[model samples]
Target chain A: MPGPDLLSSQGLRLDGRRPNELRRIRCKLGVFAQPDGSAYLEQGNTKVLAAVYGPHQASKSKSLQDGVVVNCQYSMATFSTGERKNHPRGDRKSQEMSMHLRQALTAAIKTELYPRSQIDIYVEVLQADGGAYCASVNAATLALIDAGIPLRAYACACSASMAWRNGQPEPLLDVGHVEEAAGGVVLTVASLPSTGSIGLIEMSHRLHMDYFDVVLSRAMQGCKDIEVILDRAVREHLAEGWTKQDVVVI
Target chain B: MFQVRKLANLTLFVTTTPTKRYNKINKSDCFENSILPVHFSVYFIFHRTKDYNSCKNMTRHVKIRLASERVNHSVSSNNELPRFYTPGEVITGMQDFMRGHGTYAEDDSLKASVAGVMQKVNKLICIRPLKSRYVGEIGDVVVGRVLEVQQRRWKVETNSRLDSVLQLSSVNLPGGELRRRSEEDELMMRKHLQEGDLISAEVQSVFSDGSLSLHTRSLKYGKLSQGILIKVFPSLIKRRKNHFHNLPCGISVIIGNNGYIWISPQEKSNLVEGDKDEIANVETQTVSRSERETMGRVKNCIAALVASKMMLDDTSIMFAYEESLKYEEVKDLLDTEAMLDVAFLTQHKINYVDED
Candidate 1:
């Protein structure tokens, strides 16, 4: 009974959020002028920056005849986490995260159209608040959109956690660092929300089969909510730069 | 043939209706500001822990603004903003229209796959994003840097997604026109254009995979020396019959379609017909202090226009130059206030011309 309390007696989560409440997502596209596309995204206390370059001619070693190659790199700054880290990138954990990011983003990108081309996506986590991977994925999606790359739909990612209240199991949306360190089961999901299909699913702790559906559904729903926010940002960005003369009528 | 909407004309001509326009502006401002949440202090769950510094770091200096606050404010377009589509938004049914770039067909609907304004030409629909990598078209004048000197070609980076090719066959061989390229000429490729050297060329052809083939066969197109290069988004450059201009203010500007612009002191009439040797000698010739000042002013003026998202062409550029004369020194044009003033005055001049 001495464990950290994930939920209070009144049913609000530890962070005073409801079971279905998400972290506040604030994002901006075209944050950098040098990259083909760049975006900065902040989710709660976590902040991420993503940049995308190319769809250009690929090198001989990496070129593919049938589809485009997606290259991803995930690096966390030394100051991003509670402990200072030595390496910013090319570590074992960063390598795995890079592969995972490529897998999720490639599913949403229309890669077949750009044969013999490569798209490089680099994500830098400037701050970590437990859902850094999810924030990185979301930031990469925005950067790709800013680059004007063709995509099947908006790719979104979210993390969910499970807790018990009065012996009834409930799922929490958008888990932060505090709950993540409490030895709770954290389920992360990346999906194309518009298409209603999940691209990647990762779970940190084992959970009972009976409660799996609840947690997965919560994560998917978080993705859908994130899709709405990201879509609004893209539309607003377009409206800001759009002019009446760009469209031709014939 | 897209017709400019009458509302755009009205916005320019109907300046007399200040009350209604003022109300509309205020209403739009309210709508934009209301969408974003008010800024609050950062939330830290582990306040009782040993590290209070981390909590302070979370709230550190984040400049959050609503999307509307990032708009280009140096100049406002008279044209009404267009309807925008995001990825997966169904633009139209797939039955009648052919899908183009930045669009895809899914579930019997033609959806936009990029965020931009939609354009319909005949039976084809395309989305033109506001900013993207340079997509080359034939006959486009582009400024590029030599990236690598390969067998019979020099790979040039023209701000396009791909490295463009400048073949030896396509170049003027630095001596004369109608000269056949030889093995000796191939060996001398690097001597003519080495790595990191800038050159202005014409886009001769586009490859099937979207790479451009550039040619520097004309007298106007060749190795550029002693000029400041400025790059802007390709979409901001307006396509016109002439991309090169010799401004009356004693500076020459080459507005490349790839968004790499070159500004240099205008060559005197005597220097125009210089050969390779004479051209090399001209490089050593000292450019007068006045000419250098004029060149810097032209470069800064173009930067001001680019910052405002104004259409970049010779006329608008010249207008910006004329408006920038109020600034006594060339370096002063780069300041925020002067940059905005020059852009605003140039936009006014452009609108005045449109009215006439």
Candidate 2:
């Protein structure tokens, strides 16, 4: 149900971005001193902070014999949205977001390495524009990396929406809040781009079966692009914090 | 073709902000697009204008900036940088190399599972992370706080994956090393080292589950009395033959391999050794004002070195302490500029010693 006005006459989206362009992403790793690993990420106007603790002793009930338990909690600030929200978390939507986060992150972490342990990832959304879930996944990935937890590959998430221009279906990459409210079919994909693996896929509103492939691929491409940016941030963090002792093991 | 265009735009956006208008539009778009309150948009605009004005004022006495404006503290070393690998990056073909820690073998190739520099010893290749929870080794000294007192054992948290175990049989009781642990001793465990009491111990063994078993068998290792415990990254602490140092400046420091540092007065140990029965009495002994000042200075010096992510050892600590003495007051060492100065001076001295 995306309106024709979703794209301008010049072939750019409402936010003056090309249909294939993602939102500007800025990130910093090890933002916190206490947590084992922490990161702050901003994708356009949406801001998220993620902290990873443990791979430590799991409590008696949560411990797994085969691998580590990935516990994730996603909470948005009361002021994250334009409206003043009463509850920060524990809502049904927050619970679902937390579960989706675990599904995406568990695929990236090499859990088998730390059996009988738990890795707790807590994501706090400071601002929510659009694609908050995708930003949470990306921030959590950076936190896990900052914690030095072994991972099979970086897990990146991105959301794409279908727009129409000149009687042709156009897949928009990195949907912002405005585009999301425009009644477009949004496809969110969490993937390990390097490994060509999809951890989780979700769709909101219905799209024609023929255009599904296009939207999905665009989202996957966004994830791949995000993986490259995250990889660069990790390398930059390592360079800054790398001491001589890190290189020459005593 | 779309992928190529996307990549090009991404690189362009990352390198330079030709898309500044897009960024501004994105911000304003959220306000206009959503049914959010008009006041919220006004507030955003007000904050933006205020920030812009602050940037224009050159001689402002008090400067306030957002968290996003915080400076990057990473200092690139002068030496040739080491080759670093990230997760899932293939290190080499797994024809002969044995994958070790932070690495996994998949698809006939050894891939790094963590971001760090690689270490190769013969056929064994391992990647060590820049920082992580302390992975204990046998004979490594550690300072841990008692978390739980369970059946004949005390659960001590040593900043590891699992809470380390300190069994009653492993520790030397108050009477002597040869004294048999009686049923009475089991009941008296809480009287000895209760919850939250700090203790210095050595890693006796490592369990198959990767948890450490610790022992306080030596006279040097036992319950820590009144002292300041400073926790740094375990990676910062260098592995040395001597972790306990009685500094020339009249304070003793126990640099636990787990990165828990105990800074206490020097004379306290001598007092305990002289009258063994009065071990509990030592806690009541008030530290002199001068001794407390020296301990504070030493603590600040260590903080400086840790701030710079320098390798911590007795020599490095002492060099920092000596360099910090020029700054008269101990509290002054806490300043960011002073900390950087002390760290820089200590690094110079350490490099000088290495060259010799």
Candidate 3:
């Protein structure tokens, strides 16, 4: 079984989509003033607030690095999901997410510029509908910008799931938890969309050897499509200035 | 007579009124009408009137919309505003200050304010609403409710957090220099004043903790010589602490925002129709504190009488109160155990609830 007959007979995936369409994305930057940078992003009903702390100093134990060290912390609020979790962070899942976040974020950051310093990225999921990791990455990207951290390009992540329709391979973008639970081959790709290069790719569940490239490319394309929207938002945000209207006197 | 017949019908007098239709039960049974709910808002839901067969316990839902009708003066009360507010954050619906991240301190001069942990950590927040009260400054007109008779003075519950003292000298009795009101004055005073009476007064001085000390040493405000009284929430009456408010036709005194109103008719009656007109003028022409107390009592009586379906104007309200006040028999009945309890009404097989 190429995973539980992923596509329904109506040519729709488990969550009802024509496979390639992505979930809605709503993002806001500079939502908080205390932090160097902050952003609020909602991918569908999943909401995440990302805050960037520093490029300041390398604290005692974790100091020596050849280049600027990227530290990422991923935590979810207890009430964010349908089944509330007892612990917000320090869980194995969150630890794994932190590692994955560093890998993708480091690819997009110009880490060499600030040698021996640390950039701390913290993402907290407030509400979780689905595609939480992708949302965290997108939100963190905006927060890094708000923190005035240097980036090579906007780092956007999107997921694609392969739904095996009647004799044809269908691709689903931004697979929600419901669709993921429905047992499709989910392929998540984190990339610098403009450069058309994959920063990170992870797949759960197995598809045909030949269909892997198609699924991976579709996920990458979803990332690129998201980058365009996010870049436009960032430009508009920077051009318009911060929210607490900067008082100007002529 | 024809108007009475028309009012008896379920359908109102072809011309619709918000209160007239629902007030049939109120007018016929104008006993001691005390409006239970002080807060009247868009969200005021009418609860089902439960059945309890008794006289004292009997309660009917009475809602009256009195737009117009004139009255007397009252003393004004006030509330102290916080010296400072949280920057960018708003304190809404209640007394609690909303502490946002933006609030800052100016070294030792400013206080360090932080949002309470539980308040911010939780998803829901609750704030209790506060009613506005009177702040006694240099000079302000206020309305006060006579709470207790102490010596020659009456302790008037002004809208301020503190109770004000209404001295005997400030009140205008029939003769100007009628030195010392006696026990006979307390007994016969209901003819001129009583419990729950609304009177308009003036803020003589501030009694330390922002409470008002009132005086009505003026002709315009003193004793309910005439006109109606009303009781309402203490917050609605807005008073600008000033002396002498002379309106076009008459004068008005703002009692604390609560519902105490003392209204005396202007010499020339500028005739108007319905409760709609007076509501527009509630904040106009400051009623003295003493007059507000007098008027608030009358409005309560009207609210009760009107709620019970009695189409009584200023004349009938006074008639009922006068009839009830001077009646030694009714006062005696009020003392009886059977009358005090639900026993009498229940024995008579009347389906009513007792006053709890």
Top-DockQ candidate index: 1
TM-score of each: 0.86, 0.88, 0.41
lDDT of 3 by residue, B53-156 (tens): 33124333332332232111111112222122211123343234333221222322221121111123232231111111233565666666677776677778
Candidate that would win on TM-score: 2
Residues B239-331 of candidate 1 have per-residue lDDT tens digits of 889999998988899999999999988876886565567777866778888988888888899988877768899998999999998999998
* Per-residue lDDT of candidate 2, residues B36-123 (tens digit): 4333111221123334454334322222333454544343345676888999999999998888999998889999999999988888
For all candidates in order, the CA lDDT equals 0.85, 0.87, 0.57
lDDT of 3: 0.57
* Residues A47-119, model 1: lDDT tens digits: 9999999887789899998899999999999999999999999999999999999999999999998788889
Q: Which of the predicted structures, 1 or 2, would earn the higher DockQ when compared with the native?
A: 1
Q: List the candidates ranked by DockQ, beginning with the highest.
A: 1, 2, 3
lDDT of 1 at B254: 95
Give the CAPRI rating of model 1.
Answer: acceptable
Each candidate's DockQ: 0.42, 0.40, 0.01
Question: Under the 3 Å rule for N, CA and C atoms, how many clashes does model 3 have?
Answer: 100
- Per-residue lDDT of B58 in model 1: 47
TM-score for candidate 1: 0.86
Instruction: Please state the CAPRI-style docking class of candidate 2.
Output: acceptable
Model 1 chain B: ten consecutive residues of lowest lDDT:
B1-10
Instruction: Give the per-residue lDDT of model 3 (tens digit) for A63-157.
Output: 55556778999999999988999989999999999999999999977676555467789999999877888999999988876565556567899
Q: Which regions in candidate 1 have their CA more than 4 angstroms from the true location?
A: A1-3, A243-246, B1-74, B272-277
TM-score of structure candidate 2: 0.88
